[model samples]
Target: MSSFARHRPAQPSLASVGPNKLTQQSLAKRLLFHSHPTDELPPIFLSETLPPELTAEVYDFIALALRAYINPWWTKITRYDKEFLPQVTHILVIVIRALELRIQRLNIPALVFHDIPTILSQHYADYRNALSKLSTSYASGGAASLPQLFSQMQPHTAILPDGKIDPEYFRQVFDYILRVCLPLEDHEAEAERIIVREVIVKVLLDDVLPKVTQPWFVQKTILDLLGPPAEGEYMGPLSAPPSSFSFHNLLIIILSVLQSFSGACIALIHAYKQAIITIKLVQHSPPYKSSTLPPQTGHTGPPPASPVADQSHTFVSPSSISTTTSTSSSTSSHPLQQWGSISAEPLTITQVGGNYAAPGLAMVSEVFSTRDRFSSNIFHIMLTMLSISITSFLDKLLPYLLLNTLCPAFILNITRLSKRTLFPNGYPGPQPQEPTLEEKAEIRARLVAWRGEGVLSYFLPLILGPRPSETLGAAVDPLSSAQCNTHLLVLLLDRVLMGLFPELADGLGNPSNS
Candidate 1:
């Protein structure tokens, strides 16, 4: 019997209190012996499921183990699989929560959107310090302790059950992003954090934002979180945590927002073009006289889109149609002929839009309406328009140097508009003093010159008119030369086309016309 007892392998003490208790204790002992104590954690660490103390313990243990205990041997054994990266980031996120808790319990200043960079800087500094302490600990322990490596690591399940992401998902995203900005090799301890962030943000921004069905709301939400694209504009301090702290990602997002804003400007231009068509309908109608009355025509045909609309429906305007139909001398007497058309160099800017407002009439309505975000939204459109104008000006190498002097005034006008109070919710009904005759005349003079020798004219020569090589004869410089003088060309066409001959009213006889 003594020999049999010696030969038998020791049974796990299963005859404890009860069968269930024995089973439970034996299983616990098996796990305790097989894996690190921390590795035995439940697959999930959700606050909804776990007690606060348990959650805190899980978070603290994971962060402490990863950052404070770098085992070169253990790290070498780590597979560094992409699948497990998020787990590391998850651990880091927990750590962040811990820091947040520490701050809150200690009554420290809570972070805000504007404090992203500062918070990131702080987080990184804290990480480095933790790493430093780990390095010291590793050196003291001679880097050979296997148990220390396992001490805080919980044994996770083979298949981690999926669940909802934490409410602080945005914070987690940025935390992982911070790690991704660094290479995997430079920071061995933070590889998991980097991988996790890449997955989270990829799912949120790349995969989700572009979804065919739900992308609109998602994209708009992202834009709202990031704020506007304009730099140096004070975005009154946000009390909530910053959506993202990385300048690298922030710049990309800002450009996206700006691109959307640019589309809005183009859409506005289209609305103006449509308005112009409506105005033309009013202008060409019969004056309702017995002499002019004829047969009632059911179809006058669809009003032809303005030729100067440049094929874009957005540049239409009521005033522009009036300028088009009126006599040239009459148009010249107005404040600015062809206002949206830029004096009818046949320039038309197209409409643009995206998820926030679809690219057509809806977008136009958004800009014109003064309700909700219209004021701020319109300001963005205006800013984008000005930027586009400036870019076009530079692109053309700043044509018509004499007229370029007026650019400062245009810029000042835009600045003044930008600083004005927002339009009220319903509509902007503010009354303004009409322009004086002298002001009208001056503006008309500038408008006439702008449409002639301005950069628009310069581009028209290349884009639509004959090229320099295509010129059949010695071409007199349009801006300068004796060819500026022409009388019969100006007088002969007036009876035929009226205001359509604005080029004729270019002060052909004026010596300083160029």
Candidate 2:
């Protein structure tokens, strides 16, 4: 037996087996009833198991579908051999169903109610026709039709077969149309205009008008949104009828309130002045006084005796004695006593007749001086308080009024203007008259004249300015000359492009078309 085994081919070991033998032995039981390799695996196997070549083909189909329907006009109707239409339709339907479910969950009413159904119904016939063509082409040496594959795709008995179209279904359809068809449509320009108009109207009605009525708040919010207004630009409301509330009206109201407060301040100042004047007049009035003196005895005896004895002498020299007696009597009489009393009493310089003496005037002057000083200080204090109060009131009130009233009104006005500009015929309206030829011509003429008078004089000077020379002897250096030429060329190009296509020109000259 050992000699026979050596002579015969050494029994083949399991280690020497090829892959074909291993496969046959290992898979033989699994492949018993199956003719193809794929028939043995689960139907819902992961795409990761797919061969690389098959994955690449699937990717190509997806890319082609995406690009082809991007513009509906670009669909390859002329090529009957292409079998991609049904596959694209299948993908679109799946996308639409997914979108419908999403919109239904979100509860977006506009898309559900207004837009979706219209889009789906309109595109449905075209989709069906494309699918039919793809299937017919596919049956004659092409890929299997989408419908056929779908029918074979593990019967979807679990899903309900109800045909009732949901509003959400339409929304999904519109979403798909926007994603796929809108880019491909030839009516993009018109569609864009319509969209812009709609957005403007919606914003005016919903956002802008409410803001206008509260001008102060609106302005602040707008500043926040758009940044500070440019210098010399309309930072406030536009002119309109007084009956129509605006930002300016709120400003006027604030000013009126300030004026009233100022009037109150003026009244207060007047009251203070009157009080000072009264106090001064009372201070200058003189005080009253009373006085007494002892009674005086008459100088009788000696005077009489001298008079009798010297009568004869007096008769002899009557003229001299008469004069002497008269002098003595006058000196000795109550006139002296009255003079003494008058001297003893205090002498007050009172205002006699209508005129005041210097002393009397002094009292008036001193009182008035005090009064003036007090009045001045009081007036200053009052003025300062008035200013502070007014400022404080305004600081508080202005913002409150602006936020609560002015901003909303201004926003409303702007909203109205926007509506007029966007949807002139949405409400009852007469068409606005076009500008007269004379007016148009006058405007044009004025513009042209203004431009001709040197709107660009500064620029011309810079361009024509003298260039730096490399050496005093050298004519312009080649480098400098070249730079000058380049500058001129760039300037010329800028002007030409701006004149021809102002919209296309940015800081850079027109961007390269390529």
Candidate 1 accuracy as TM-score? 0.19
Q: Model 1 off-target regions past 4 Å?
A: 1-34, 37-95, 98-190, 206-514
lDDT of 2 by residue, 230-282 (tens): 34332466686569778998999999999999998898899899867754544
For model 2, what is the alpha-carbon lDDT of residue 240?
67
> Which lDDT tens digits does candidate 1 get at residues 211-303?
312322323333444444433222566587666578998899899999989998898899899877755554553221111001101111211
lDDT of each: 0.31, 0.30
**lDDT for model 2, on a 0 to 1 scale?**
0.30
Worst lDDT 10-window in candidate 1: 289-298
TM-score, candidate 2, is: 0.14
